[model samples]
Target: MKINPKFFIGLGLLLIIGYFLQDLVLSDSQYIIGVKKKRQEKDDSFRRVNGSPLSQAQRDTFKNLPYYAPDRAYRLDAQYQGFTLRDTLRMATTGPQPEAYLRWGQATFILNKQEYKLTLYRRAFGTDTTLFIPFADRTNGLATYGGGRYLDAAVPAPDDTEITLDFNHAYNPYCAYNNSFVCPLPPAENRLNVEIPAGEKAFHE
Candidate 1:
């Protein structure tokens, strides 16, 4: 049977639309998958490397690290409030010595109608590109680590006021795993009163 030219054109258009629709649906799934993959890789590295914070005994019996269920809502867009006079903050660590970090700025975001702010920081020395955020939520000492979790974000552009905070990517400090390591304690300003049910949970012994 001879097919009409219009039929072929219509079929092509339908195929194109379907392709885009599938892409849109898969984009979110793909992003979540990437997050999970990165976490798994990090866990694998800790277990495999001898220099990792995890003791050999812990690694010997290690199966998998605990994590909260990934929720899209936990990934939020935030407004960056830059500080004019950057303060030098001396952060207490698990060890006797404290690490110095620059008080870069704060990022404000609203969750459940509650406006929350997280103080961002950078290493006092070297070319700092990472925006470090150590935060404690209500989940601490319960579902998550008591000392709190960390979320690293890219430094926002000088003129850019918007940034993304993915709490689902939050991770515990090395001190949570072993006492031999020194991890910076989250500043009081970074603590959240609300329960953050996403990201790494309390480590199993």
Candidate 2:
């Protein structure tokens, strides 16, 4: 019996495609697992750890903080625009006094075919190497915290031109769980017109 050459070619192509599809599925599964593990650790801290934002009573009744399902789409690579002259931005908080932060840079990215930008900041008095991003979106006062959510990124080096912004890790401020804590509201420039459905949802809602 003669084996057709085309049959072997088609079989090889199917095997290659199957291998890639399997790899993609594994990658997605790992991402989702990692996100869930981090979320669970946070919940554990809130429930049993000291200095948690949750009150004793709240912690006793706490099950888990709500969050949107993990999605790769919400993670983006943004164009980083660093400032030559950093300016002080006194961000208003829930309390009377405002918190000071240095306007470090800007991150511009496109979502849903539209362009958006967010100003990044650093603590005015700390030696921290993290970039702070407090932002509000259309989800506020509906599915998520009304006061907004916060994201953190590693400070990009001066020559770095791109940074990753993962909305999946966005979290509610401490003030969202406790009224005594004063949390900085998202600056007006960081208020996005779009809805970000990822990250932690409202503690009360």
Best by lDDT: 2
lDDT of 2 by residue, 76-149 (tens): 99999999999999999999999999999999999999999999999999887799999999999999999999
In candidate 1 the C-alpha lDDT for residue 75 amounts to 94
Residue pairs with backbone overlap in model 1: none
Lowest summed lDDT across 10 adjacent residues in model 1 is found at: 46-55
Best by TM-score: 2
Weakest 10 consecutive residues of candidate 2 by summed lDDT: 47-56
Residues 16-134, candidate 1: write the lDDT tens digits: 99999999779879878988898889888888866678888989888878998788889999999888899999998778988999998889999999999999999998786799999
- Candidate 1, residue 87: how far the Cα is off, in Å: 1.1
Compute the lDDT for candidate 2: 0.95
RMSD of 2: 1.4
Q: C-alpha displacement of 155 in model 1, angstroms?
A: 0.9
